[model samples]
Structures are given as C-alpha cells and as structure tokens.
Target: MSAGLIDVHAHWLPAELFGLPSGSPYGAMRDQDGELFLGDLPLSIRTEAMSDVNAIISDMDAHEISLRALSPPPFAFAVNSSSEDYIDEYNASLSKVVTESTGRLAGLGLTRLDDASAAARQVADIAKAGVLAGVAIPPMLRGASLDVGVLRAVLRSAAQHRLAVLVHPMQLPRPEWSSYYLANLIGNPVETATAVASGILGGVLGELPDLRICFVHGGGCAPAILGRWSHAWQARADVRAGSSIDPRDLFRSAYFDTVTHDLAALELLASHAGEDRILCGTDYPFDMAEPNLPAFVDSTGLDRVALQRSGKAFLGVRVPQTELQ
Candidate 1:
C-alpha cells in the first residue's frame, strides 16, 4: 500500500518562462483566459495556481504525490525554433526553475525534433546543470519522423547521455479538422501513435536498444493495434522490408504512461504495453485530467505488486511526502 508515489507525467507553466496567448500543439492558441487553459486542460481542473510553487505543493499533497516530473508544454517542444535566441532563452530559463526546485520538483526537458542534434546537446547540458531527469521530444517536426537518418542520430545522442525521452505529438494547426474538434479528440493521439510506431517499424528501436522511451497518453492507442500490426508484419513479407523488428517487438522495448482515465482502457493498455512498461501520470493542471487521479488508478483492479511495479517503482521517482505546499 505504501508505494513511492511518483507522478512521472506532470506539467508546470511558470509565468516567467512562458507568456500568455500561448500556442498549444492541440491547434488552438490558449486565450489569455480560458478553462482549457494551455494544453487542452479544463479550467475547473487546470488552474493558474499551477504557476505558484507553493500552490503546486499543496495540490500534490492532496493527491499524495511525492515527486512530480514536470513536463514542458508541448508547444515548447520545438527546441529548434526559428530563432537561436529562442533556444538559448528557453533552456536558460528552464534550467533555472528546474535546478532551483530540488527535493520537490524535477523536469523532463523539451526540445525541437527538427534539430535533434542541437536539442540533444542542449539536453546533455541541462542534465549536467542538474534537476532534469529526461528530455521530451515530439515524434515529428515539420513532418519529419524520428526514424529518418538525421533524427535517429539525435535519438542516439540522447541515449548516449542516458537521458529518457518523452515523445508527444507535435502541435500543428489543421483548419479542416477544427470543425469536428478532431485536433485533440483524435488528432493528438493519432499523431502520437504514428510517430512512435514509425520509430519502431523504421528500425530506430533496433538500432538503439538502450534508448528509454516513455509514450504519453497510453501510447496514443498503440497497444490496441499492435497485434494487427504484428500479424501484418508476419503475413506480408514486404511489410518490414527495411526493418527486421516485429511490430510487437517494438512495443515491448518502450515505456508508457497511464494517463488514460478509463479503468478498462488502462488495463488494456497495461496488457499490451505490460506492467513493467507502464507508469503513472496525471497531466496535472489540465482539465481533461482529474485532480484525484491516484485514487482513480487505485480503484482499478490491478494487484498491489503489479500496481507498485508498473506505476511507481519502475519510473524510479519517489512519491512526494506532502501535497503541494
């Protein structure tokens, strides 16, 4: 019952770091004031208080979270911004906040996939500076997959540095899909699924076996379709012309976060991704995610050992001693 409560997937938006009317990968600019404030989080759930260190501690205490690994806003993943100044400013600011939040907070740095090498170097620098556990990169940047030769090198460099990779969807705008609210409902997950799957099927996993990848949003439905993919790979010879890895083989090598709210859904994700591959996440300060997520996860029919192994210990992060305060 007493597991190290590590929220492997949490977020922070220090006002000093990012300004208002921000761009979210979800296709909408967070209006200076909105409920689903930055990153599709609901107002009732995600609050401005997230910017306050003390308030964050209080919220974590209420949820029994011991250590929350803070993820940057998906929009910030473009570490290779149009401006070099952007990269320098973002990294310096991020390093300051993360380094100063010792004992209570840690960060998963974000970088632009388009320039993986530069991003990787920045991540290494951040790691050396301290207070960062990993780096977050989207599957694609400007429509290029991580499987591409250039980007693969970026991934390898990250592995060399022993930095964990958090892969999310790129926040791109699509006017056509806006009408149906598809940007988030389907588009986001679809993006995640495609990027991660491409890296696996493209032989990136085989090439760099030591890479530690944690997929967000329950791997964006990757688990559910893996069997079909595996069957196709075996049934059709050309299905894997360039890559030798069986589709299912790729799934086993990566890690996934249990951000899915549905219990049955979570269980199915675990079944495919496996208990060892699964970790707990709440996507704090987001409306789509509940505040009392740990309780909801506890309510699932998972056994104590399975829960501890899959949810906490495997992530290697300790639970907070008190909620945000």
Candidate 2:
C-alpha cells in the first residue's frame, strides 16, 4: 500500500445505532437474516462489516488503502425528523471508533438538518471534538433543495470552522425508479446532481468561498451537464436569477470522488475539475463499492499520487509516510 493512499469517501455504522428494541428513543431497527431493516424496508446488508472496525481496517489493508475517512451512511442521517439526540449519539459513537483505529481511520460526524441553528451548533461541536475531519450531509432536507432556506447557515458554519463537508445522497424511492434498483443507480446520481446545481446556481458556493465540499459518485451527472449549465447561465435571465456566479467555475472549485466506474468519465472529471480536486473514494463495504480501488485507478491512467495528495488536502490532515508491512 502506498503510504499516502487515503480514501475520503467511506462509511461506518456503530453497533449501538442498530438492532434497537421496540421502545428505543431512536426508533426500532432490526437485523433480520444479516440484513438491517428499519421497519418493513431493508436499510442495508452486510451489517457486520459496517460496524466491525477490525474488518474494515483489514479490508483497507488488503486493498492497499492506508487510511479511510468514515461517516455513517445517509440512511443514518435521520433527515426526516428533528432528532438531534440521535445525531449526537451517532457522532459520539463514530468518534470512539476513530480513536480506536490508531491513525488508520478519521471520522466525519453527522448533523440534524431539520434545524439550521442546531445543525450549525453540531458543526461547531464536531470541530471542537478535534477527532472528526468533517461532517456528512444529505443532498436534500425534507424534500427541499439544500440551498432553500436555513441550510445555507449549516454550510457557512462548516466553512467558518474549516471542516470539510461530504455531500452524499440519501435517495428516497420514487415510483418511476422502482425496478432494477434504479433508485440507487439512477436516483442517487440525479439527487447528487440536483444538490450540485442548487449549490452553484443558488449561490451557496459563491457565498461560502472557503467551504471545502466534496460530492461522491463522481459528482453524479454534474460533469456531463457543465456546458449546458454554462450556456444557460449566459443566455437565459431566469437561470441567472439566483446567483451571478458561473456554474462551470463553481463546479471546478468543489471536489469530487473517483467512483464513476468508468475510465473515460473519470478522466473527463479530472480534466475539468483539475487533478487536485479529485480524491480517492471506494464507498467501502457496500456492494456497489469499487472492489479493488488501487487496481481500478491504475487502469484509469491518472496519477494515483496526485489523488493521494488531493485526499490529504480535502481532509486538511497530514498523514505520515508509513507503508503497510
């Protein structure tokens, strides 16, 4: 494993958050046949791997990943409710995991998006905790865009604290995307693209210039539509109503993870977003994750070392050069 190989996009769930009893304050979650289900809907499979720190570290070692930044998957965000208590418990559990990893893991805390002021306070608390590199947020809050109202305050707080923000998608099942797992394969990317557009066209990126936000899944479909957005920005008045910042420039300023699952697509993203803005991400322990991230990047013909450096920059942490034995 390269000493500086760091994965900025990965997920971890503490055992305390799952397998809940009926009267639990955080709601009931059950583990049925090794699959985690919240109510009648299945939340995730591979529950063991998600909660097991040792297994995660071993998998990272096997895949030549020297370090990983862990966040709870979007399902754990509890975005539908104003449940700061659950968010607090989740972040506290994650901090303990980071401390136990012995330099192999860094944590990204969770925040309740329903309350903007509370969310900002959570960001401040996460920074003060001194163990988390950033915070993970869903692309939407209660069916509205991220830039809609008070959400911008959350982004502003993140920037002021110098903490990175991971914009992951927690896609709800739509009627049109019901079959063939389109909810994840198609809905997820669309959701991410929506968030990216909202951030750019709505002026969140321009307002918070210091915010270090990274979108996963190769920034969804945002890269492919940059030219169209740029054209609309220049040719249409309504498109320019929200903010005067060019969508292309705002897109370039943000960071993206290498999870496009295509060499040409990744090359296109790096070319436009700049090599320094591309970070290594595996979406680890999920069935949709890249099975062998190092090998996949090597096949892309992009510079792995540059991606390593980009991961370091996004996290704002210096990882020592220590090769795995």
Candidate 3:
C-alpha cells in the first residue's frame, strides 16, 4: 500500500464461541474434532485466520495494515430466544479482543435489535465501552425493518454518540435462496440495499441527520442501483407522498465500504456515495472478501489523498496528511 490500511470489515470470532455451554440462543452440535454445526451452518475453527490471533496480527503486519475494525460474524447478532447475558458475554468477548489487540484493532460492538427501547440501552452501553467504533446490525432484526419505530430509539442513541452503524445482512429474505449459495453472493447485496432503503424511505435519515451509517458489501446494490430506486420512488405517487426528504440524496449521504471485489463496482460506489465517504473493507476471512483489497483499491485510480480521506471518513481513523506509512 506504500502507506497503511485499516480493514474495517474484519472479523475475530473466538474459536470457543460455539463451545460455551450456557444458554445459547440456537442449537449447535460439536463433533469429536471440535467442528461445529450451528443450525444448518457449519463452522471450521481450524482455519488460521479464524482461530489464531497471533497469525492474524502477523498477517496484518505483512499486509501493512495498521488496524482492524473487528466484529463477530453476522450470526452473533441473531435475535432469538437468547437472554441478555448471552448477548453481554458475546459483546464482552468482542471487547476483550479489541483491548488485547495492542492498539491495532477497533472494536465494532454488537447489540440487540428486536425491541427499540432495549436496543437503545444496548447501544448506549456499547458506546460506553470506550473502545467501540460502532455497532453492526443485521439488515432486519426479527422481521423488523431498520426504519421501524422498533429501532428508532437505538438509532437515536447511535446518532447521539456519533457511532457508525454498519448494516450487514444476516438472513436471506426468501426460502429458496439456499441454492448454489446465491444468498451470500446476491441476496447479501439485496439485503444491504433493503437496509438502506428502509432507513431512507421510512424517514429515519431525514429525522436523524447526524447518524452515520456505512453499508458494507460495497454498499450492496443501493449505490449502483440508485437510479432504479429513484425511478421507482418517482413513478409512484404513493411512494413519494410519504417521505419528507429526497430519498436519493438521503441514501447518497450515507457512507459505504470498498468491498465489492470488482474495480468497476468500486468506481460506481465512489461515484454515488461520495469519494470521501468510503472505508477500506475486505470482508476478511470470508471467501467472498477481497483477497488483496489494498492493492485493488490502489489500482482504482484514487490518489493517496482521496484514499486517505475516504478511509478516515468511514472508520474515523486519523490518517496523517503527510502520508500514512
């Protein structure tokens, strides 16, 4: 990179997360080898990137990455029959990783999103953790949209603290999405777009101007498909009749990550979401995540200043003007 990088979309799930013998929200089966099956999803902890912290730090050193904004994988935010302590323990585990990363990691906290009032309290608590960068949420929590009144209080709390809201999808919206793993490849972007749309179309963005949300997965389909959404919004009077603000501009005002893994997609994202509103992201340790994002971003024709500004804006990381190296 010639400078430095901060991977905003990295994960650091402890290998023992599924092994805890407490009140788990979901049923998990552990085999003799410690391989796990949490519901229908299988987890392999033997992977060096997923299991070994030292290996992760060494990789960051090799990649010239100064910091990693770590969050638990999306399943960690599942809203189920889980108790509050379960959530607390998980978030506490997340916080400890940040505290132990030797200033090389920024922790993105996790919170409950099913009920607005409870969600608000959790957001405040996560912010008070002091090392928290922001909170990451599933596109929808227990079928409640991001713009619903059920999430208003949480959003308000986040706005008050200037915490970044990372909108990542957790479930496929349809039953047939399991085919060929289309959900992760295509449904994820669709869900991300849905997340932002819920915010803008439901008036959350207009009501909370101070809120900073960064949609990962290259902003899903929201940025690139703005024209289609705008057209749909314009073509229907009922759609335009409710919103008090221009949904297009509101969506554009949001932040995005450079995780598209395609040069053209990143270009479209920068064009719409603003060049300064993007952060470096690779969806690290996931197969779909960019294998070498810094080099890819460097090749996207963005000069050093633009790159530095975008990274700083999305993650609030201070990039010195005299170059980041």
Give lDDT per model, in order: 0.66, 0.82, 0.72
- On lDDT, the stronger of 1 and 2 is 2
- Which is superior by TM-score, 1 or 2? 2
Among all candidates shown, the one with the greatest TM-score: 2
Q: Is candidate 2 or candidate 3 better by TM-score?
A: 2
| Ranking of all candidate structures by their lDDT, best first | 2, 3, 1
| Cα error, candidate 1, residue 82 (Å) | 4.7
Q: What RMSD does each model have against the real structure? A: 4.1, 2.8, 2.8
**What digit string (tens of lDDT, one per residue) describes model 2 on residues 1-325?**
4444689899888777774322322355566787766677676567677878988998888888888999887777766666666778888888888888888898888876767788888889889888899999888776667687556777889999999999998766889998988988999999999999999998889888889999999999889988899999999998998889889888888999999999988988887798889988999877689888989888887676777778888888777744321
lDDT of 3 by residue, 228-307 (tens): 76787888876665476777788777878888878888899888777777777877776677777667877887654565
Which portions of model 1 miss their true places by more than 4 Å? 20-47, 79-82, 303-325
- lDDT tens string, model 1, 175-278? 86766557766777778888777887788887888888788888887777888888888888777864798878778788887787677877888777677787
Give me candidate 2's TM-score against the actual structure: 0.92
Task: Candidate 2: list runs displaced more than 4 Å.
Answer: 1-4, 19-29, 37-44, 321-325
Ranking by TM-score: 2, 3, 1
